[model samples]
Target: MGIQHVGEIAVWASARDGNADAFAELFDLHRDRVFRHALRLVRSQHDAEDITAAAFLELWRRRDAVRVVEDSVIAWLLVTTNNVARNVSRSRSRHQALIDRLPRGMYQGEGAFDAVDAHIDAEHRETTMRGALAQLSIADQNVITLCVVEELGAAEAAAALGIPIGTVKSRLSRAKARLARLAGDARAAVSTTGGAL
Candidate 1:
């Protein structure tokens, strides 16, 4: 076996035996990819780091169950990253709703909105795309994250999501439609505000 395979086998054995060092080694090897996956889903560096750490914590806690599979640790990381990212999204959505419901002038500051505005323009259109994606259903969000953001094929996304490939295609189609509507709305809002100014 090559170095990676040998390392994976060793880590698997040590993890099965509940060795922290082995788990740490596994974490070190997978952390960057895991963080990137989390970043792609969560869309915030801080949240992504937190999610990645939480995922690794769960993996460490469930070390015995984390064996060397065909995709090795990367697949496990993706699964964990997805779950944690959804949790983070839910929390943020709830918090934002509460903030939105607050009386105007109760909370003061355009700082956050200003920051978002700064990221606008064609060069940062990906940020706009991500914002539009946030308006999608949770299921659609998962499908888009796996298939589009993560660049997994429909069949692979279906396997990851425990659904049929057809289902993945259907969800992605709806997600794209919803994303387009949301993007249009965002653009309209920006245009109206600019006209007012």
Candidate 2:
């Protein structure tokens, strides 16, 4: 059998025998996608790696509850990764600290004035943006993160966040408003600088 067949069989067998090799094969099959998904949510490479490891470990822990259809390991990984990512978010003090560290200037797009400066400025702005995003309510943030950042769209975001489509829409609206207010303040600051110039 190909890797696809191997994955399904391994998951099925691992579910019964607690076979570490079977679990390892499953991890090999899905780790990259899972890591990328976690990275998108966690926004730190190190955290993403940890989340990926933890997710696979958790999958192995609950192997019996896992069901598989042919080559559908990615779906299973996505679900597990989502759960692990949320837990990682809840547990990480450094994640909260990053939010607190969002510099006021970065949001205003005011870090530097030259080409190299602009590149550095963009990095800081991203950091600040992620930090600000982390400050929103988890429900609101998850909506925007899944729909906008992850490009998951309305229905997919709802599934990932485990809410009704209407709830997803409601939360997304609130998140956008909060994000706009944040961006607006940044723009006003930029304009004030322009006026001074």
Candidate 3:
């Protein structure tokens, strides 16, 4: 093993032994990577930040169960990020449904209306990407996030996901095709609607 691997093992061991400073060091070392992975999975900066925080919180909560792979806790963080993103997405969907059920006139103030419009416009692309990802199976989404978005090799992704390399390859292929089709359909919809809504 390299020097960095040895260092990581030491850090992980310290953190596992309830060393708060060591755990914070681990967080500082990996926060950006975890945040970026969360961003890709969730597609909203704010939500990604939330997911990143939640992932770390989960890491602390599950410290006893933490499984380090290849001398790093990143694999565990990525998996936790995925799970947190799913929960956040589900909660957002439920909240939106509740909002939609509210009487329209209840939200009809001019400031509220303008704010809603601006928020929707700002989130259009994120919404589109999220929709595209939603079209994929959870397994496919996980593969795409690990292999494509995070640029992990097939072997590494398989290790992270506990799947066979062949399965990662096949799932990535299908996920890519599905994302392409979804993008095409989104573009067609935009053109059909003359870029409105």
Candidate 4:
């Protein structure tokens, strides 16, 4: 094996043996990548940070069970990040539902409205894009997140997802088409409602 591969294996071995510094090194190496992938899924920096943290926590918790690929644990971290993001999304939706059901004016006025108008507009666009992504099946979402958003090669995505490359390609194709359709529908709706919705 190459020198880098040997070094990575040593790190993994140390991490598996409960070496905190070694694990921290691994975390430092992959945290930004995990955060970026989480952001692509959640579209909020705060939420992405939470997901990234959770993924690393999970990595430590399941260190012994991790499957190292290509002399690195990044693939496992990515898969765990995806799962964590999904859970965070579900929990956020449930919390939002509860908040929505609360009677209006019960919470008083403008608690977190200190954000600037431009920031609000950017947040709205991000929410709209996330909503469009939400319309796809979870499988399609995973495929698109890995292949399109994360820009992983089809083979890499297939390996990360534990599926055949052909499956990744087909799902990615369908996801792209679905996203396009969803975007078009959103535009039509906006035009029909004169941007009211």
Candidate 1 structure quality by residue, lDDT tens digits, 30-148: 89988987776655688889999999988878766653434456655677677777788889889989998998878867588766546544333565566676567667877877677
lDDT by residue (25-132, candidate 2, tens digit) is 667777887887776666568888998988777777776665443434444556566667767777777765775599765555343434543553455455446555
Output the TM-score of candidate 3.
0.84
Candidate 2 colliding pairs: none
Q: What's the C-alpha lDDT at position 82 in model 2?
A: 62
What tens digits encode model 4's per-residue C-alpha lDDT throughout 56-173? 9998999888877667787778778878888887898898799789987877543554343236445545655676887777788778877787677898878777789999999999
**Candidate 2: lDDT of 124?**
45
Residues 107-143, candidate 3: write the lDDT tens digits: 5575886676567656566666767886777788788
Candidate 1 vs candidate 4: which has greater lDDT?
4
The lDDT values for all models are: 0.73, 0.65, 0.80, 0.78
What is the lDDT, from 0 to 100, of the residue 78 in candidate 1? 74
TM-score of each: 0.68, 0.55, 0.84, 0.80
Residue 45, candidate 4: alpha-carbon lDDT: 86
C-alpha lDDT of candidate 2 relative to the true structure? 0.65
**TM value for model 1:** 0.68
Candidate 4 is scored at a TM of 0.80
Candidate 2, superposed: residue stretches over 4 Å from native: 2-22, 40-44, 62-122, 183-197
Lowest-lDDT window of 10 residues in candidate 1?
Answer: 116-125
Model 4 root mean square deviation, Cα atoms: 3.4
